[model samples]
Target: MPVWRRYLVRDASGRMVELPSRALDKAEDGTSPIPGFAGRCVDVVAAVLVAERGQSPQVAEVSFTKLYFDKSGFVDTGKRERMIRLMLESVADKRLARIPNAARAEAAVRAGAARLQLADEFAWQPGPAEMNEVMLRLDHRPAGQGHTVH
Candidate 1:
């Protein structure tokens, strides 16, 4: 199994309200939409915070964004792609518009899981320099030792 560590910034009130990074790719379910920092990674983190805190805070509303892709390693591409697609679809189809802030955060996690799945599909074949370049350019840290973010 592979995992991606997601970083996020939030305020004292704890509302998910920031887009830290942009999507590198676009999937049917809109997993990684936009090529730059303009998505909902922060929402995912907010959901996590809400879960951890076990109650809503007084923080103002915040947007979720992806700061970077902290990769664990490459696994099965086929499975990853399928998972990402499924997760995105699930989140997209859900009635999030009416959901509470905490629920919306959970939805972001589901969506992120799918995105991570797609990322895991890539093969580990890039050099350190190349990987560094991706990290510097996109804030994406490759997962595997020799893997690079594409």
Candidate 2:
């Protein structure tokens, strides 16, 4: 059976909007306008999930990442930089080690960034080189302790 996940986008006022699975794909194409800031925020969250889980971009996942990158633009901006800093800090927290997997950490980063209205850049993108870097870094750490990259 196919699994379906409910993705939520929240406005500045914190009202949640549920997006259809199809919307995520459209957003990735860059053809459709992002529904709104909230929807775009949710898309970032989904992308983080996909990256951390090592999953291929399901239509929903790619859409979220595309919207996030498009709106937030790249780093070199204060907001995006701060978001990455915050994400790194969160990954270093001891409490995160108890969580067992990267997916939860990714979700937390996404939610926290949304709450802070932080910009989302391609900082989370994991290419082969990036993955290799991550693995090398993890190899140097104690077993079962690795920084969250997404």
Candidate 3:
């Protein structure tokens, strides 16, 4: 027995495009260019639903962290400080708890920097990050028309 499902998504010009089952069923989000971060951050989500390799979910977080925080093994010293500052500002503008699981990687960078900083390079453990993900699920409701009582 075979079950066939068709996914139709609106494309860039506000037109609906039929998506192949291969794109929908893949583990990847179908829009991510870097293949990590769970496809939740605005930067990553710009593409939306990217394909995923075998990389772990944390690859984007750690990769960007390293790029921003670490010297990157080069003498240039990189944009670490500026990146950290932007993160601090972004967190201030956005509420971490409100960002949702669909965008975990971006939310963490923007809101969870402090936590991620503590985790740092090679020191990050999945426990706290995982806990936060679970918490994001709280108070969730299916998106649709709203009902109001006067």
Candidate 4:
């Protein structure tokens, strides 16, 4: 008799059967939802952001893939997004003023695993309370483009 034994598991229907590790990995309890960059939330966030900006969807997908999709299935999209927002600076009036230590400050807030609240009108604009202290400058749409703030 062979010394090695076949491993078996019970299915949801209460049936005992032998399955490969790959199948086991796909089981309800075996898989855990990935958070951030490459997860479901990232797709939603990217989709909303691109659409709101009237950006090309193809470019948005390619950009998302390039930034988050690597060999592994893990990325912290929250901190990445927050850092990008925090690093935003104004480039208007021929002057540039960056947020002071934006990365460190945002990182402290984005360290935990919290679910992002998505909605029809989801917007993530980082800025100062006073209008004059705005760190970033947005470009005006071309003439007749009819740009509307969401």
Which one is best on lDDT?
Answer: 2
Tens digits of per-residue lDDT for model 2, 1-150: 233543444346534345554665555454454535422333232322222244432222222232343452221234445666765654453445566577667767666665344334433344565345334422333346433443
Candidate 4 deviant stretches above 4 angstroms? 1-66, 76-150
Give per-model TM-scores: 0.24, 0.30, 0.20, 0.17
Model 3 lDDT tens row, 33-91: 22322222211011112214552121111111122111221211234454556556556
Deviating ranges (above 4 Å) for candidate 2: 38-150
**What C-alpha root-mean-square deviation, in Å, does candidate 1 show against the real structure?**
17.5
C-alpha RMSD of candidate 3:
17.5
Measured over all alpha carbons after superposition, the RMSD of each candidate to the real structure, in angstroms, is 17.5, 16.3, 17.5, 21.6
lDDT of 4 by residue, 1-150 (tens): 111212232234533334343432332132532222233222211111123444422111101111232223343445446444433321121122354566545543443212122111122432233111111112222334322232
lDDT (C-alpha, whole model) for all candidates: 0.38, 0.42, 0.33, 0.28
- For 27-137, candidate 1 gives per-residue lDDT tens digits of 223454433323222212321111123332221222232222313212224444555566565565265777788878888778676555544442233345533432343
Error of 2 at 33 (Å): 1.7
Backbone Cα, N, C clashes tallied per candidate: 20, 1, 9, 2
Model 4 lDDT at residue 103: 55
lDDT of 4: 0.28
lDDT of 1 at 1: 24
